[model samples]
Target: MKLCILCAKQRAVLKRPKTGQQICQACFYHVFETEIHHTIVDAKLFRRGERVAIGASGGKDSTVLAHVMKQLNEQYDYGLDLFLLSVDEGITGYRDDSLETVKRNQQQYELPLKIVSYGDLYGWTMDDIVREVGLKNNCTYCGVFRRQALDRGAVMLGVDHIVTGHNADDIAETVLMNIFRGDIARLGRCTEIVTQGESSIRRSKPFKYTYEKEIVMYAYFKKLDYFSTECIYSPNAYRGYARTFLKDLESVRPSAIVDIIHSGEAFEIKSTVKMPSQKTCERCGYMSSNDTCKACVLLEGLNRGLPQLGIGKESRVRKQIAESEQKELPTVVQHFSQIQRDADAPDIIQPRDPSTVYTPPPRMPTGVLDPPTKKTLDW
Candidate 1:
């Protein structure tokens, strides 16, 4: 029975599943963000007078997220200095176009925007990582480095928490991915809105229940601008398959994605599963189960041209790390050997956080790179 705020056209959007008071779709978009702002305030997601940053990519999800958060700040009088935080991945056509969108976003929203480039953060772009690691699992490198770089950027900006544009579809895909991988520990903690930080800056996903399609629709109807380019080296065949599966399933069941999110929330893991110990990585100071993080290990491997440090279990990758320091084994061999070790170490393997599902990106025929993909293209 709620009326549209725009043309006074009343609609049936009153059944929006209780996101802290539902309104029409137009109003819901506005109210949903206000709800998130209140949730952040009530949950103390940010300090009363702290600086906050939006992980702006100039994409629809991010652009909508940034705009809503800005409106909420003004309406609710949230006492936080907000800005846009972007990563320039240096993929030629992909990221350059995205960065252009971010620039436009800065002017449109009147928010201070900051860009942290991979060339500046790690001295290697996605192009460089692909050239070295190839298509098999280079995503792991992009994921790890981009995460660390975001924190490093936030640290430079002196912000407490970084908000991403991740919505229900992304979260659902991650949950499925973790479930498929049997990462139970991650599954248990994936829906955590606020990731408590010990070393790395805190992070949160405010739009956890928002749908990607809805976000796109909202942005389109609202005429909010965003970047729409795909990454050049997105070759995750497995994830792509999963995404297709999800899309097909969604066609059959309209609420399949949200249902999956609920399943992730409802399912419980056995108490006997031992979770990864909370420890700090000595090298990078991020949360880790062992002495160093995967990022630290991979960086060490890259510096030595030993791919082994980038993959495998703690003990196994540790051994590879040690071997790289001493012997001259092919790092790729050492890397797969760690996988065998990982296969054997079932005790350490836990279920991934269910809220995080993996969606395979659309497949690209491997040939030559046309437009350089930017570093921040992945979900």
Candidate 2:
């Protein structure tokens, strides 16, 4: 029996994209699936013995990705040792609720699922971090920390490559965000299907060209178990703007998104905007362009009373910290953190009064600092 792509109903709409080759929705889905499978093979995203960890969020995109990848790998005999890697962000109702779906996914697919969480490594879950940092900064910390957590998990799993459920819409949204911010290098790198050579594990996005709507529909037709809750603290204004803009465009023109991404790959840049070289984080030894990665920097902010770690916008971090010693007063009393810090306000260095026993700051043995000589300040 033939299938319908437009509605997934038994009856067909007999329509394809206004542009491009004429194919039914079912046929289009097959095309999407075949193209994605071929893309993975052509890109050489997996090797015979190497472990591949699918970044499962228990959401639609991930659910569909895991399903499709599992099917293709076996059918094509890709020789991939597929494992599921889910990073629990620990949002009370959001992540806590969603994680159940991941657990169920393990049973449904009969794939070995490894769940790693922020609470385990950072001693702070999204819930705890949100309580201290508030909703405004929750997603920022979660996203940054989640990236690191995934890498760390892959390390523990001894996997060499990590595949995320990042679909075309997400990729399109990110591209627009980077372009709007004038981040040429990130814009160039963000579209990369496979990231290799730097981090502990290589990361790739097999669904990089798939659409979110199609993924959701695929999950629905397949009747796959998935968690359908937005993160409780997903309050990123910048990314929200990009998402809204993309959705608006998607409504007006269906192929607008895929076309945009293809153009992103196709567009040639004559300018010399080289991507900054990545170095290991001085604190955590993770791959980063700066001396310390964003994750390490945010971790420092949380330990200190710095507001900037929670808030990534330099303007807002500066505004909040201008009142007092914000995020940048050293996290060390007697030792130095490995972070190559941004310029700190100079006023905080005066030694406290001897009578007032100020507790030493969080200590990191970075080994490059002049020792703090305690010349007691007058009370």
Measured by lDDT, the strongest candidate is 2
- How good is model 2 by TM-score? 0.76
lDDT of 2 by residue, 1-379 (tens): 3345444554332233223332344665677688789889888888887788889887887888888888998888888888888888777656655666777677677777777778777767778777787766566787788887777767656678999989888888888888888887677778889887334478999988776655654565456777666665765656888999988887678788887787677656556756678677766667777776676667767777663653555555445546556435442211122322224211211222434432222222121112223222111
The global Cα lDDT (0 to 1) of model 2 is 0.67
- The lDDT for every candidate, in the order shown, is 0.67, 0.67
Give the per-residue lDDT of model 1 (tens digit) for 1-379: 4444444664524323222232356665665565667666766676657678899887888888898888877787777788788888777767766667777678788777777788876667888777777887777887787877677667656677788998887878877888898888878777667786543467888787776655665665577777655576675745666677877876567588878888888878778878778886765566677776777678667767875566756778767756654553232211211211112111211223423423223222221112334222112
Alpha-carbon RMSD, each predicted model: 12.9, 18.2
lDDT of 2 at 207: 86
What ranges in model 1 sit over 4 Å off? 1-44, 198-200, 325-379
**Would you estimate the TM-scores of all the predictions?**
0.76, 0.76
